[model samples]
Target: MIELLIEQRRRNLGGGMSVGRVLPFAKRRMVGPFIFFDHIGPLDLVAGIDRSVDVRPHPHIGLSTVTYLFSGEIMHRDSLGYAQAIRPQEVNWMTAGSGITHSERLEKARAIGDHLHGIQAWVALPTADEESAPSFTHYEGNDLPSWSDGGVHGQLIAGSAYGLTASARTHSPLFYVHLELEARATAEIPSAFSERAVYVAKGEVEIGGERLVAGQMAVLKQGASSVSATQPSTVMVLGGEPVGERFLYWNFVSSSQDRLRQASADWKAGRMKLPDADDQEFIPLPEGDPAKPS
Candidate 1:
């Protein structure tokens, strides 16, 4: 009964770009197959003085764009050309099957000075794989799979839990851990997971007993597996292996709603082909939001 999946609070959309306080899909409530979850920017770019993040090139069929940085530097270009530069904890896994186009900037050698925190996730693809074609992967930060357990400090960047396995190659059967407790900790989550959630970013967390702070987001209700952390906290645990039935519009995630209305008529008839950036800046498509399916 503890289901409140979209609190939304991060909305700055300014120049440095910010808009991820919560945009839970299809009217809210963690849409099917996991649709949309933006938490971009921890904010603050200073180093030499360029600070970048220019998002242009759009068009996605099913979905999979999970870029997770904990602090600074991001340079990812797409349309299948693939150009990379992701620092911090490192991870830039893109998989927009069927159709693609991408852009994500802020790496002019750290945009001059250096400092550009991060978080960008949008995973929704499982309708036989939603076209399945485009692909890209980059998992650095020591290749992911850190471990501590007592003083807390775990990192399994994508799929698989406890035992550890984070090379970032998930289509389903997901996990995505990244805990970091300092004083107290305890984890044992595995009830087979049909759905689960937890997204704190700094301190305090006790799931199952309740007590989650720092940006709050704790949704767990289907059988209630297991999760713990009391003091030195920093969490992010997503579930997986369920692509039951889906069809989300906006960013286009489909199991068939006519393939999200043929990808909104191929991105409004432009046909679809935008990826390629020199400076990066193209995020426009929001007017009369209704192609049918409500």
Candidate 2:
């Protein structure tokens, strides 16, 4: 049986880029610590015009941001005085323990024919660690654990899965794996964790007698399950035990609603410090949902 199959919602960000939002739904707020998940373009970008994805500096709290790219590269700058370039298969893990401000844009050669494809997710920290010191780390793809068996190639994207543990520092028990299968290949997803789900990024897959296409998130039923690809496919498996509950407003996530509201007020009052290199520009609170991540 399948728990729930979530269809991605399109959020157009102007400038010819569209993000597929897969979490924080009204029906289900989160899967483990994953409070927010966005699938950014597999889209072709123009040279100078579509070059920079100037998402200006913004504030966040009580969560860790993971940016994984399948195609292009991004420049990440944070208040921790770190400026790092994240390329394909690299992980930019930023922990906004108490609070932090950061910015992201295209890599310097934002050249033409550059395809931007990636998944940016927010993992809510446990309450005890929510106010811990902020930090950032970049994990190269080669440092991560990867394996291939019976025509299925998989890697531990973050956390632990499939008898492999990622070097990426995670505060809680969770699993995130990236898998690719050849045509007509089948793989049994292990039940090592308490909760699990798989998101199809490309190709056709069958789970529980139903076909899941690209952009579909299938929450699995109890125990282990098998996924078979009718054609070449790429998918990501993610989940863990729930971290209790969390409140989210804008990019702020906390176990306390009052804490979240206070962070929102802080942002509105300009209390968060900005990075020196990218200090002047700050994305203001949206008049609409204000639910937008920084």
Candidate 3:
């Protein structure tokens, strides 16, 4: 059964920061253990426009932030006093073990105009590793594994595939790949991946006998291998070792619901340090949600 990872178009959240869509785990029907996914933007920025997404320091307990950009530039500052600028095709992997806060912003560029496109994903960590100290790494584009087959270009941005591993270090086993196929070209999904999905960014693709256009996500059922394109296209493939069963409440993910509750209270009480820097932004929790019962 091929399920669609419904596309939620970017919604304006003001401050020039908009979220494309928030996909909850329940809606995904349990493809690989990935509980949440967000497609941030293909949004454009104008020259001389002072815009930035300063997420004020907030807390995350048991997850990792995987930042991938196709265009534009972003400056990342975290609680560890780590400051890094990520360009297109690079991966900024930050793990929030017990708790941490940070922010991301668009850096001013010299180009006459600027275009911003990227995806931000939240991967749940294992139960035992939830409280581990925070850490961060930036993988340059050239450091990722790349290959050509059937006239198509592919890059292993994170995790491993086709006997190649990208430099991006991940806690749990996962695969994050970027494939650019030429017109009428074909590429294959290795059988080793425990589970996987195809997200078409540009052009069109055919997977498991179904056609997927830009912005559509085709999530594969278990035991199925191999995905090919009908036209020249670019797609992101993500999969990995299953995380088993867990609960996600707001920004906290844990095997026990009580842990999430405790973390929330700690964050609200200012027990945790917001990620490192002045420009960070914080996302407010929705009102009256029992999961966030203060």
TM per candidate: 0.33, 0.94, 0.88
For model 3, the run of ten residues with the poorest summed lDDT:
285-294
Q: For residues 1-294, could you state the per-residue lDDT of candidate 2 as single tens digits?
A: 588999999997654668999988878789888888898878776667453256778999999999988888778999889999888778899999999999987645365446778899999999899999999999986767999988899878788777778898999988887789998888888687777888898889999789999999998887979899989998888988788878788888888877876788888898988876785867887663434332
TM-score-better candidate, 1 vs 2: 2
lDDT of each: 0.68, 0.84, 0.72
Name the 10 consecutive residues with the lowest summed lDDT in model 2: 285-294
Poorly placed runs, candidate 1 (over 4 Å): 1-56, 61-68, 73-102, 108-110, 113-119, 123-179, 187-194, 197-225, 228-234, 239-244, 247-252, 264-294
Q: Identify the leading candidate in terms of TM-score.
A: 2
Order of candidate numbers by TM-score, starting with the best: 2, 3, 1
Local distance difference test, candidate 3: 0.72
Model 3 per-residue lDDT tens digits across residues 108-189: 5424555777777778787678778888889875778888978779888887788988886677888888888887777777
Q: What is the per-residue lDDT of model 1 for residues 1-294, given as tens digits with 9 covering 90 to 100?
A: 346644657665545577565536444535324566676656665645443345556677788878887777777878778889888777888888888877776655343655555567777877677798989999976678788756767778887777767888777777777777764567665446677777777677776677777676666777745556667777777767667656556666766777777677777777777765544445655564434544
